[model samples]
Target: MNARDPQLPLQPDEASQIGAFAQAMWDEHIVPELTHYIAIPAKSPMFDADWEKNGHIDTVLRRAAQWVEQQKVAGLTLEVIRAPGRTPVIFFEIPATKAGSTDTVLLYGHLDKQPEFSGWRSDLGPWTPKYEDGKLYGRGGADDGYAVYAALTAILALDRQGIPRPRCVGLIETCEESGSFDLPLYIEQLGKRLGNVSLVVCLDSGAGDYDRLWLTTSLRGNVTGTLKVEVLTEGIHSGDNSGVAPSSFRIMRQLLDRLEDAKSGHLLPTDFHCEIPPERVVQAQTTADILGEEVYKRMPWACGGDGGPVLPVTTDPLQVLLNRTWRPTLSVTGVDGMPSISNAGNVLRPFTAFKLSLRLPPLVDGNEAALKLKALLEDNAPYNARVSFVPDGRAGAYGATGWNTPDIAPWLSGALESASQTHFGTPVGYIGQGGTIPLMGMLQKGFPKAQMMVCGVLGPKSNAHGPNEFLHVPYGKRLTAAVAQVIAAHP
Candidate 1:
């Protein structure tokens, strides 16, 4: 009878406090803030070598810190600590009472955005945050910029209710779009200071679509390399070499073709085998039923290309999720060595290269995968033309044994469920997000004892990182309340 209840059911006033706070803030306060934020193209130095000189990065950090400081959450203070050459990380903390009574939750997010790639519809650029059809569209909005607001919105909402809270620390990273190159150093620098975190909530990624809130159980490791095909020592005029030049680009495609099955989009090499675990298979099936045809339709594809529904995003949500979270998959992210249109010439380029990004499953030894991939690509090169691989980057994938999950999941599930009943229509569905957040791996290593929750407002069609990327304004506003409900009911 003396045991504390597993959940602290919210009083009506408490529930109102949560919802009203988010709704009010988002409608008037949050959107404007995100609008101004999305306008700053603070590309990561990892992606833009001259980011500092561009000055947009500094502007972004300052604006984010300023917006956070304005939140008036009692006892909450924001700090920006930066090592000499490294990017800045924003830290904010609402100190808790009775030190050990409520656990400390370390909240993480990022402020940087990806470079704007081509293919944006006119007026739908990365810097333009547009509102249309129940969504906020912009580059940084979903990928991570929204997390800054989402984290603070949740933290502030709980405080507005006067509920005693876990010591929530907001860890805002700057290089997330670029593989978190500076995270380890930040973690090391913050060393003992980041000690005693009880739970980690990474607000970077989100559910597959918009029906549910997802938990990331694992992230696929990544190996990025450039495959270069050198067909000849010198360029030859297309008129003279039309038949004999042997296009380097053509050769590159042929090599790539051998790596994957053209029909089903499956990787052919046995070197990248990963089976969807049975439990996850069940998760996928459940998700498939919930998602139905909408899942495939949500994907952005070329015009007249499967414009209608095709196969369920993955017949297995778990398998689909696994391919994203755990398995190794080859994606040719970029191609180079071809001349541009403005300088069009009828000459065969001497060389061509394709940038490849390979996702590695859990326990697939990152180094081993890199080596295996290098060998595979080299061997697959067609016509014995000179070929070489340029190592871009490599990192290990991460998987946390959800051991403490069983203990903490009830609180998370219930909190979100309660909020969903009020805001979303149903209980928050548990799902997985595919994408590499290296800091999650570092945090998992740094705080093995801390149970983590990774939730956010980014949806599938949000098109983060690509052109026309945007955040769903009202949805994010409501998510703040959802986070608050969970925190208030944390047992």
Candidate 2:
């Protein structure tokens, strides 16, 4: 086989070969690497404060780098770049096989894992690897320790078949699960070394289903922080302080009322919301039609008193999709100054604190929202309590802004369509993800003309950041081939 012209689309036989190559690569190498990667608890910097001392992040980074180097792709140069007090990044570059091509395809993923959430099945654990029924069950494997492996495999598959491709670069970071706080610094340092980035392949977003290729069009911004309300200097007997001193929990609830409507679950502040673009609305409607009841039913709802599944906020598929993707929502992820039921006592706690995670619309400014959120929760405290809302991250980088993808170019759109049809036998699906990817927004600002192919294997019930998280191995194999096809078709 000879290297084909970069201008021509991949033929059916060529696509088949690419698919087979990807499958073989996954079976022979990638899956085993991910299995070992899953066993290491390389939690993100925020989750593991002692990441520098613990060295788990470095272990994963070094392993991935070693694996990439072992591949020995022609004209490849790899580096594990690091700075003081920051997580490391694996930066690798492959010169273009196509003559006179200057554009770069920046492939992005992360090796960091989320904290160990509860509720895994008996046989599955966050750090315990299990492969069952074509699903790699464990933390980080799907959300997305397999990204670097899949990315390199795609490149190798193309090279193996003598297919010409443009310059490709990989930026696999170790701080994404912590909102990618360290990425901006590295991106700035890499500046011109990143080349004229024309396409970004971010394999960190989600898929609505495992049937076909799904493109993420928009992502919600996030503002996380701790909101604490101190009503008393010290704990007191509940019997003595019931009427005299106000309960910190009660004051905390009152303060939260300023931000959210408890009954409707709506964010009371209008600044956090943004108008849903018409195109995105149309895409959401299409996705809703395809997904139907599964849009809401996919949630692991608890059983109701009547022995039926608990109802979601809404059953209308379009509304459910929009509510999650284009609306502002608040989640109190953790609480402090509360004792377990087994350790409960008749003493009023001195303070009440909550770890707040606020998701804003794609167009909203996360830092601005964070500032407003701080003022809203801390002002006019109930019973003159000492209340504060401290936003997460450093002073200037308190929140993570969301991303709205630019209009897809004709060549890229056709490539995506052809790749999806070739791999999954369906046209590409477009959907907006409710989760935030901080790097997407940063890249958009850095490379305004770049086409964002933000897709991933996080399909229905893959439960990332929660218990029993697994990577759909079959979907992953197809996705890898599909990615190679798209890259081959890149103009």
Weakest lDDT window of 10 consecutive positions for candidate 2: 1-10
How well does each candidate superpose onto the true structure, as a TM-score? 0.87, 0.99
Least accurate 10 contiguous residues by lDDT in model 1: 397-406
Deviation of model 2 at 38, angstroms: 0.8
Task: Give me the runs in candidate 2 sitting further than 4 Å from their true place.
Answer: 1-3
- Kindly provide the TM-score of model 1 when superposed on the true structure, using C-alpha atoms: 0.87
lDDT top scorer: 2
Candidate 1 root-mean-square deviation in Å: 4.0
